[model samples]
Target chain A: MEIRIENLTKAYGDFKAIDNMNLTIADGDLVGLLGPSGCGKSTTLFMLAGLNKPTAGRIFFGEHEVTDIAPEDRGIGLVFQNYALYPHMTVEDNIMFPLINRKVPKNEARDRAYEMAKMVQLEGLMKRKPKALSGGQQQRVAIARALVKKPEVLLLDEPLSNLDAKLRVETREEIRRIQQEVKITTIFVTHDQEEAMSISDKIAVMEKGVLQQYEVPQKMYLNPGNLFVATFLGTPQINVFDAEVHDGKIYCAGNMLRSGCMVPDGSYKGGIRPESFNVTLLPSAPDAIRAEASHVRMTGRELQIRFNLGANEFRLLVHSDMQIGVGTPFYLTTREKQILLFGQDGKTVGKF
Target chain B: MNRKAGNVIANILKYGVLIIGALFTLMPFLWMILSAMKTNAEIRAIPPVFFPSKFSLENFTTAWKAAPFGRYLVNTLIVTVFNTIGVLITTILAAFAFARLNFPGKKVLLTLLLATMMIPSEMLLITNFITMTKLKWIDTYQAMIVPWLASVFYIYLLTQFFAQIPDALYLAAKVDKCRDFKYLIKIMIPINKGPITTITILNVISNWNSFVWPLLVTNSREMRVLSYGLVQFQTEEGSAYELIMAASCILVIPIMIMYLFLRKYIIEGVTQSGIKG
Candidate 1:
């Protein structure tokens, strides 16, 4: 189902939990609602699932307005963060519960439950209660239960958070594969940027109940609409510095990082990805900005070097062969000529 | 070794105090049984005879003959069984509503109901009696049973248990198209078996042992409960020690049997609910 949310808002007394959010998820498109905790990603997901009433909005599944519909009538499958599998029931019964309520024939419900369980690799564990299963196994049961009814839209709320690191990876892969096989329009809410990037066709980045950007994972990284989106969607974080643009040049820490850019002369926040910095030990390099390495961590094949630019610490990810150490002076330059600039209002300031 | 000895001494003191308390509690039942078999003079004997010289069934026969004890037992069971069913129904519905449903005045209503628990039963007794009389329900089984059918304390207890159920499960049920009442009966009630059993046992006990209301309302012999008979056994002439003791023995038996059977759930329901829920 194609879910279109129009001006959705949820206010808890004076605080707006979801502030006038609008998003369009196309049919059979796997979208990820990515954000930090309390960023209203889950609230958006709940509104889409009809689990929560939007304080102000119209939600549509295809062309039908379903904003006022009950959760059971919404035809959306929701897997909760904690799984929320009925602890008393066996896996088979858990999956079959919705089917039974729909008044499907007994044999057909059982057959469909078997198929969902098998799809999630829980075939032999149908008789086992959720408490007796491992976290990963229980997660599979939750997925199977949610999918058994063959819902048109699948909603998952941090479905992998309860597992250990290894299990999270494995189960997320399984979820991705299952979602593909089912071809249901799946929207999963997650605080993990990497998970969203890894599985989503389009990732909607949100902060403080506002939608910052909605684009493909790589595009969201390459071209963020604001400072928060740029900083939020990368590992080791994007480095930001307060700088001024003048005479077609962007100057930061007494160096012109980018020139021939037609941005107006004004102070702007500068952003550079950790992987974008080029490190050279030679101090008198013109294109490179100099800083003393305060810390160097050799993480397998890559060296994570940390330095101070004034009061803020800056991090750079480079090849381990750079042989950088603490207190070593190195000059830095961006691999790309144009640095990302955000104005005082926090929106992207200029053309690339 | 010194710490081990101290632990042993502490354990001994704990069990020693517990043992003494147990005896103090059990003493009355034992004394009643012993006195029931004795002659009237023997029961009144100073330094009250620990044991009867001759164990006789005479008190049982006399008590059984004088007041139609069998009919009283039957009448009591009828009231108790019906009242228990009624209370369980009312309690489950009220508890579920209090635990899950959102409506105006929920907080204020809950506080008011809790406040009602603090009012002594004695304060409401006269008002209840007047109501029963006005309804022309006095001396009726419905009069005896209906007035005590709903208990705020039991509803409060079940609400605590029901509240402990995750909202996630409730949402999950809603997704599966299960109605609220169906979820309550199939999911909530069965899962909280310990608390439900506790409520049933407690209701049965209160109804079985009810004295003041039954005594106040029922003037006829046919409508009397066992506790009412026990009061009747004591005449205005004097207390009939032998018959009263025998009647007391009969009343305690059923309660003891229920306690023995459901003691684990009772203890679990009473203690675990406050912290666990």
Candidate 2:
């Protein structure tokens, strides 16, 4: 089901934990609520799941007013980060809990629990209690329990945060596969940008309880709406430079950066992804950032050359075969399409 | 000072200390049991007898008949059962409210509950006795049960237990559309069975052995509990040491049985409360 959150707000005494926030999840879409800790991502998810009521505003699930609805009436499945499986019950019983509470027959609940167990790839562990299972298995059982009721929408709040590195990777892939197979209107909340970018069909970036940007994964990465979105959406984070515009050129750190396009007069900052830059002492092409190489390190397939320009250090990725030493000078040219320029207020000024 | 000798001495010291400590702790109970089975002369002997010279069931029979011991036992059972059940039900419900539900006066109410815990039971004894007397509850079961029900300590214990439960569990329950009361009974209560069970055993033991409050309120022989019954059994004509010991054994047996059955829960309850205290 499609979900609409309009001007939702939650306050603790005087502090607005979640300010006037708005978001809309299209039906059957896998959306990721991505943010750092306490940025209102989990709060938003909780409000949507009907766990925490918003102090103000409304929520709609496909034209149904769900703002004031009780959690059980919301028809949503929630997989908590801690799993929340009943410690005293066996896997089968924990998975069967929702169905039993809904007055489903015992035999039917057992059958559905077993079926969900198989779906989560937990076949032979039904008799084991949650405390008896390993972390990964317990997590799978928790997922199975949430899915057993066949909720219209599934909300996962940092479902992989508790797992170790190997398990986190494995479980996140499984979650993505399960979400795709079910095609439920799913919202995954996480602070890890990489996790969101890799799995979500669409991503909503939040900062300080405000919606920074919302778009498809590729659009959010390639055309960030602001500095926060740009910095939060990419790995090997995009490099930002404090620059000035003069005579159709961008001047930064005692260098005239070549750009085929002219930036506005007040555009004081520009962001460039590392992959956009080409490493050379003198580029045959124009519009390149000039700097002295201060450090170099080999990273398996590439050499990361750190350039020193004034007080700032910019990193450039180049082929490992290209030998570069410290104290060497280099010119780094970026593709016109990959540059994301921002103004004084951190909002996007222009992009080609 | 060789290794073998050092290890042997260490083992000896360990067992010696443990055995001595065990005997020291159990001496009183041992004395009571021995005295219960002894004649009055044996009980009053110059030095205490570890074992009785002449074993007799006479003191047990006398103690049983000297007062309505059977009726007191029944009264004690009724009061204990009602008090335990009342404490458990009220504590769980109120703890759940304080732990989870958000209402306008939640903080104020929780502070009040905690504040009530700080008032020692002795402080309320006079006021409670007055209240009971004016209400015409003296010699009534209500006097023994009502004033002691809804204990703030048990509520605080349960609140701590319920609060340890992850918020996510409640959220998951909510998403399943489980009613609030049903969720409390089905999910929250079941998950926290450890602490709740511990609290129940504790409440049972305390209520069963209750003396002061029951003594103050119950004026009739029929309403007396175990501790009060023990006191009332001793007459000024002559102290029946053998009969008192026999009665003490009777009182000790139920608590021993309760502890044996719920030993695991009792230990856990003690340790959990120890950390908090």
Please report the candidate that would top TM-score against the real structure: 1
Evaluate model 1: give its TM-score. Answer: 0.93
What is the per-residue lDDT of model 1 for residues A1-352, given as tens digits with 9 covering 90 to 100? 8989899999999899899988898899999999999999998988888888889989999999999999888888989988888887898999998999999999999999998888888988999988899999988888888998888999999988899999888888898899999999999999999999998999999998999899999888888889999899888898888777899888776667787888888888988878887778885456678888898899998999888776656788999889678888888877764378999988987534
How much is the lDDT of residue B22 in candidate 1? 97
Clashing pairs in 1: none
Question: Which pairs clash inside model 2?
Answer: A72-B177, A258-A287
C-alpha RMSD by candidate, in order: 2.7, 3.2
TM-score (all chains, Cα) for each model = 0.93, 0.90
Q: For this target, which candidate reaches the highest DockQ against the unseen true structure? A: 1
**Which candidate has the highest lDDT of all?**
1
Which sections of candidate 1 miss by over 4 Å? Answer: A12-15, A283-286, A298-301, A350-352, B1-3, B54-58, B274-277
Candidate lDDT scores, in order, read: 0.88, 0.84
Worst 10 residues of 1 chain A by lDDT: A330-339
